[model samples]
Target: MARRGKKKGRPVSGWLVFDKPVGMGSTEAVSKIKWLFQAEKAGHAGTLDPLASGMLPIALGEATKTVPYVQDGAKVYRFTVAWGEERSTDDLEGPVTKTSDKRPGEAEIRALLPNYTGVIMQTPPQFSAIKIAGERAYDLAREGETVDIPAREVEIGRLELIETTPEGNSIFEIECGKGTYVRSLARDLGRDLGCYGHIATLRRTEVFPFTADDLVPLDALEAAAPKREEAAPEGGRPFAAQGERFVALDAFLLDTGEALDCLPQVAITDDAAAKLRLGNPIILRGRDAPVQADEACATARGKLVAIGEIEAGMFKPKRVFAG
Candidate 1:
């Protein structure tokens, strides 16, 4: 009997801005993309609920290292709030917990927008991913346990009412910093307006440097990959022969450097890049002499070398990237 070895996928790297469709969990979307690309490693910057869709930035191979940077960036979302009913999850997925018929008028909704903008205290939905006592709050909530999510300060850059419907539904667009939950916003707004509400529809339009325009639908990505015929005798998977034509997964990848676009760039010499790669700091020179931001991307010949901090006239490598 022949011993079969584990199959190792290709060492693909870079970011894939996926337009995650509704009804699919973020984890499921990442797995599907990973398999389609046959990537060695994959991860997503943030989790978009199964009920919500759009702009999920997936990181493959080395790009996984930059997930934190993208996750911390600002996000924009457009959602609809359905008045007259409140759900346990704050979104349509959960059971209805309360009901009311008092829908806020357009004038009242506009006035309330200012109260939510800027920095304000927000209590995350009970059925949320937040950790409580080392377990997910949602898990506790589902088990019929009482969950009290405390209020925390979150920054909302902008919150505007887009439209209102006579059927007790309203659409809104919000630009907010990391950690802000749209479900919580909907839940609170209803309380303030004397009407119960829950998120009827939700879609993330932007996540930092990536926008809806950058997203590649799942179907398109699947079509781009070459179809595999069958498992080869040599333990390799063979792609269907297409007469002198083949598409490499790398063609679909955006440079990993794009993930750090929000950071200021500092060009460095080959020697400096080599030093940074070795987890060491390099003193800046010329126009790059004075660091403009506390943190900056150190690049060599236009390729990212490391993300580091500027202190004492030196760029100290905090996170080194594989070039």
Candidate 2:
């Protein structure tokens, strides 16, 4: 779909997934891409901390509206935990406040991981984006206040100890539902093995079809501005032509598990174009009135443009797809 304009604030719509590198937070990565593309509308589906790297999905233009659905997809990660060291942040970025003389066995460690699978409650580390009262939990902790973060339910479908070392550290690959904290799992694994532990390394391997293989190196984005522009045909997106990537908006919406297909596609009737241009919500008619209302949906797809629902019945122009 073609973007609605050459004016300011309109963004080219599509999905841009990157192999984020360690030490760059998800927001920073998204910001870099936004600046490179010169896009005003962009945001990431999930947050990967500065200490970790891997598949980071940045939604641009209309795709940004689909963040909740995309970010909620199951995630997989490969990580390493250092034994004998406990950090306040549950990662290397934290201060090492504890140590252990005892080493943990691999046999004992495997037994504890299963207990974490399925449903469990977790307290956010003092260093997290969760809010406590009016302030972010991490901010409160940074101020030296004791952070009594609340425990909330999260699901861990699979967390296997991929490997281990005599150094007391362990490597793991995890598949978990949204909101699961791998850092906490690493820390708890350390505890279960009778030693303190912290996450020494982490890399997200997958978020749906996007994987580590598709990720661009963090160093690539950090290079001094290149004189040549990397033009993305669909959005007129200009960024360094490294491993940067994109997925069409139509495919993005249809692929979402949401049952958008159930709704009938209504033609932009001559009477409707003005309203559509004004960005008003309108119900589409199907042979079955009840079904139309029940599946209330809207989409406008053409040469380089695809706009979908802003809400139930409301349609907004999303992106202008390049041919």
Task: Say which candidate scores most in lDDT.
Answer: 1
Candidate 2 residue lDDT tens string, 99-124: 99877778888778778888899877
| Stretches of candidate 1 exceeding 4 Å from the true structure | 1-7, 230-248, 291-293
Give the C-alpha lDDT of model 1: 0.86
Minimal lDDT window, size 10, model 1: 237-246
Pairs with steric clashes in candidate 1: none
Candidate 2: list runs displaced more than 4 Å.
1-10, 218-323
* TM-score of each predicted structure versus truth: 0.90, 0.72
Provide the lDDT at 100 for model 2: 94
lDDT of 1 by residue, 128-227 (tens): 8999989999999989997877899999999999898777699999999989999999999999999989999999999988877787887888677766
lDDT to native, each model? 0.86, 0.66
Tell how far residue 83 is off in model 1, in angstroms: 0.5
